[model samples]
Target: MGNSFSELIKNFDKTRDYMRDFYIYGFKTRNDFQYKSLRTYDDERRRIESWLGDFIKFSNSKKGKQISISCDSSKIEENPLYNAYRCKSFTKNDIQLHFFLIDILEEDNFISLNDITDRILDEFEISFDPQTIRMKLNEYIKEGIIISRKQGRSLVYAKSPDSFQRLAGNDSDKITDMIKFFSESAPFGIIGNYILKSLDKLNNLFLIKHNFIVHTLEDNILLALCQAIEGKNYVSLVNYGKSHKKTEIKCIPMKIHVSTQTGRRYIIVYNKQWKRFSALRLDYIKSVDILEVCPEYDCYLEKYQKNAVYCWGTSFGAKRPKEGIEYIKMTLRIDEHNEKFIIDRLKREGRNGSVEKTGENTFCYYGEFFDVSELSPWIKTFTGRIIKLESNNKQVENRFYSDIRKMQKMYEVK
Candidate 1:
């Protein structure tokens, strides 16, 4: 069991079992999907048990033990979990208790039993039996190595800072920093469960235990949005804006947009009654109730795909080009600094348009009119970086100049 060959064989078998289960039945939590294949269950259980045992044995080894880990309190404070806890429906008592527990343990350091127990009772006012307290401490200790020193009749227990340092030092900090930075800085609409899950799995593997309340909320919203997009049915949602509106809308969710520049997530949906495309912010949707029946729109998915390109918002109209495609040629004079950005944008909106580099610092963008108006603001954004060279529609040029004039007048006033 200690040898490399033995470990390799054991791990290989465990991996094979996991792969078989994943392929046969996918992953099923206790509350979800009930139709589990016997083969999948049998394999999954074996793999999980094997992994647990291996991890335990590994923790007992010399290489797995540590004394301290490096952690930045400032970084943790800015995590999405902290924000989620603030917004989520957690009781005040629960929040206080959870924070107290975390504070007593002090993430990267070790603490004695007497100190921990006393702090818990004094701060949380909970007096558990010594045996029960020990049991609880042991559970967390098992997840990581606990360094202990004999003091009087009691053993002072603390996480091995060395072990923590080892875990933290090995790419965990980089990953945590990456996730934390992106989650906080990313545009509001850009946050999604896929990124959250990715961060969580990475943190779990690296033993970088951090808060995940926001990630949980993100997952719930993503699941509901996905269900709606599949034409499952109408959903009852409460808007979180100033008005605090509540309504049940039968919507055909068409597309999800993640802005590269802003990093926000937006869902474009066809509001049945409005008979128009609507952009909904994922975070503002308080709750969603799935419907039993699907939508009755014909070619809704096709229409969404055809129009959701190079567009900022959902506004595909009836007068859209023939067979739902309209083309427009726009010329822009871009400087060297803005050339890369414009090229990237053109690539993303491929087939909807084409770009030709006319000069050292100029390009022409010709694209179909799925939602040309949406591009107006984006074109204006490059005022200092680019100039509109030519517009197929004279009205478009006039509108741009009109907007610029209005902006100039507004800025001109002291």
Candidate 2:
């Protein structure tokens, strides 16, 4: 037999980790992946190519062949990266049983597990144990591919009627529009993409801006976190960072926060042990285990709502002030007549920040937050227009000037 087996993966986390390194980070040569073995890297590269052959591109680099994912987000209806998650592992019997069971139930009649086992033996000349058949049926039932109902004492399973087909038949245009929107905008949107494929439809109607395609990889994580948040349940999450050391954290999930600039997603949670609320990056979260429902869920949620107002971006400041506050004030040189949009943006995108006209063609934008540093990126957007920047934290003020000086030196500005 040849060395290569099926490209499908058994462990998604390993694939996801490698994918982020090569695909998201991009231009990673084989040698760049030093943590993993060369063989393992090659296998993962091959697997990624198998799943996203069209989008996978490589070029010769000084170090080695630089692997990267290349795709035009605007042209694509769905993110191709999501296919990584769908590449589930299967055995020979799994494929065989899947077809056998579906074919048996495609008749649209309810059949018992024993009946299925017998049919497989007589019709397909293959014998699957009744228990194995039952398990497969249960899985299909959960997936909505099959439906089970009580028939006398035992249960009977039947292939589920095509709900998508029926819905598409009634309002094809509306359904197409909705699916197109959902596939691009919503979490676990790849399902919408699958539905669109089934309908033989394309997303020709809408153009989405600021769609974060990478966020789809974290959809499974989001689903678990959202479910826990909905149920007021505490969750234990395995958060992995640069060192890849797993740190387990137990917290009460409050809300999901998405950045408009980078399209990154974060879950704001109340860390009971720390007695503080913090936002954890969704991408960094390796796994989430739903724990028991929080008894103080409501109280924590209320406290979080108040705490959220102080959150400028995601960081709730490293050092909570004695007065429980930090502040930032930025003076901008806006042409009051021509640059009203600048003032408008300050009001629109500033969150809890206040913008006021201080003098002729000058505006002051100020906000009180838990962390002044969190607003630095937004502060930098008005680089040329910034007359002065003041903050209670000296580090925040120093860092702004430090970054400005670095940029000036890089650009060779006097």
Candidate 3:
């Protein structure tokens, strides 16, 4: 329907425009999209329907009729809009000139601008001005696709050396195999996947347990933020929270954390205005554009490293005298003969903590961690085994008791 569908991998100007609008501001009525005329609106609507007809839905309400895409995010195996970044559009002139220059230029000979233009007209019957040809050649030179050399008073152009198989003959096979694995496993593996596909060596040998669907479409954004982090730069993020309200923030991105169980990702950023580390869900971030390198980026990194010692989960506690520092000690009367695995789990899950045998069958897991209240779910698993539970935070103790009381009342246990 659009130029993106015509090309395999490049820019799709029309597809980008239509998709960008729908993605950023979804659930909009016909009146919400203010076009110059009704015909223009209908044209765009038709184009959108053509691309995502299966996904799109219409609804009527007191707020007037609206159009939306009903997608079960958890069930989505592939993001449809991923093609927008892959397929790029090209002009007729670009196609003609690319072939013209390739045909005229030889590997050994260096041809001048005037000679190249004359040859293009004589050989291919296509007459492009010297200025247009010069511009295109200069662009190619910048891209390192072609080479230019100064011969006498004139400048000449030639093709660059072929470097397809850059690896040595001995290690080419090993390197190719590594690329195949990295293409599926790495964070920005799509680039490697593209290369592998071109070589026709594409195979899904590694079957990952948590194959995140959003990771494919979100790779472009992830790459930009990663680059910014490496450069010690700030990123202006247009993020949406649980409320679906969009807000913009200029933050110095520090760390990226991924939950192994959920396959969810979060980025920890230092908010300049708030003067604290704020964690934002990666999926909720609508857009991120890199800004100038921050002068205090290194300082922020050092501060984060120091502060990370207290962080239990993703949350960095609020500013206070001690900053919500607390420890939770969960002592259980575990019957090792019946459930030896419970003792093993305590030691395994307890990071930089101790699991001690207080009695023949009792074990005490004593750990000081920030946000111990977040560990309530894990504590509940040892309901029958829990002999004693203690925490420095009063709120945690109160909530633990409150939950036990609720369970007792519900089960009507004496």
Candidate 4:
């Protein structure tokens, strides 16, 4: 039986050698297909060999001297192949075994099989079966070396810290300890460092947390919209109307708008049946589904881009004169206290214009809007501080009065 096993091993080695030689020298084709295949095989073999070497090193580590590799177990579990073979016991043992090896390697800077099994049994509270340990280590080596290192006559093992911080060109034990501390405490430190490193190349700097639910939802919405657009599929969305009722609408998603006022993102979609552009709040989108058919309209993405500054919401479907400019000129009286507040409000609402000091404490503000309705409430915010000098649109003037009246009624107490 031993002779047969030896023969089988010899045969496998010979076969591998033959394939390696064939891949290196025997591939001569104009199509480049065979050459590509040979290159891929070589790459794969190199990768496998590298990982195997690391695994052997990791398995030979001593107690409290293992290399720790930073990896999220939950992420690994998400893969279907890994999930299938993953058992709770296996995961627990694997993590402990890796940690144990890491500790041993870090302490002594080298490890052997004898040291590893003994420490595994002692620290992990698992009875050491040499055969089982050997098999598992070999299997893990084949899988990948999450963290490991080679040393004289044996291997050292450890976990990869989440991130690393460089010391001041000084190789000190204290700095190494600090690196470990930061890795354990601040996993995102590495990510922040990378961002700062390439700040010069970035057009915009957006600092956000990965686990933030609102940002996650916004990203999902954008992804879905891009997918729909690429697939030429229409979408059915549920939106909250003026009546505050959930209204179902089938629309072709054209563009997405992010509002600085509320820090909320919205979708600018063309409603086919209604033949108009409707602004749908991303949060209010109850559900979205891809439809089979595409809408038959020349998408006005560029036109919307050019007129975004004046536009109110995404309702740009209404036809207006191309040369006409919509202006909402208003006079506001502000005390020294409210002057800064009004300017900040204007910037928030994205109303572009200039503020000129008309009086000692008052200012004349002139702004253009595609729809004055959108700016009415924003203007009305300075109820006591503002008095309308002229309003071209009666609806806007009425809305300001209505808002003021509502505020007055709240204080009426009659």
Q: Estimate every model's Cα lDDT from 0 to 1.
A: 0.52, 0.84, 0.74, 0.51
Which of the two candidates, 1 or 2, achieves a greater lDDT against the reference?
2
Give candidate 3's error at residue 76 in angstroms: 14
Q: Which stretches in model 3 have alpha-carbon errors above 4 Å?
A: 1-85, 94-124, 129-162, 332-344, 373-389, 394-414
lDDT of 1: 0.52
1-414 in candidate 3: lDDT tens per residue?
554333333533344445555654456766766754555556656655655667777778677776665555444433445434445557888889888888788777888999999999999888898999999999989976689999998899997765447533578667767777776667777666666765777544554555553455566567778999999999999988889899999999999877665556789999979988878988677678999999988899999888777666676766641557678888899888988898899887666568999988989988766677767777887888888899988788889889999999999999
Model 4 worst lDDT run, 10 consecutive residues: 77-86
Task: Write model 4 residue lDDT over 288-314, tens digit each, in one string.
Answer: 777775745345545456766667655
- Model 2 gets an lDDT of 0.84
Stretches of model 1 off by over 4 angstroms after superposition: 1-77, 86-220, 227-233, 239-246, 262-264, 274-276, 293-299, 310-313, 318-328, 334-351, 358-362, 384-396, 410-414
| Model 1 / residue 298 / CA error / Å | 9.6
Give the clashing pairs for model 3. 10-86, 10-87, 10-88, 11-87, 11-88, 11-89
Ranking, lDDT, top scorer first: 2, 3, 1, 4
lDDT digits (tens) for residues 11-54 of candidate 1: 22233323323322333332232365645444444433443332
Error of 4 at 97 (Å): 18
Superposed model 4: Cα runs more than 4 Å off: 1-219, 229-250, 290-299, 313-326, 335-350, 412-414
Candidate 2 on 1-414: residue-level lDDT in tens? 136766788888888788777667677788888788888887888888888888888898788789888766666766788788678989888899988887888536888888889999999998777888788888888988899889999998888887676657978778788889888777788888888876787677766666667788787899999999999999999997658778999999999999967877899988978888888899999999999999989998887777778888787766453365889999999998988888899999899989999999999999999888888888899899999999888899999999999999999999
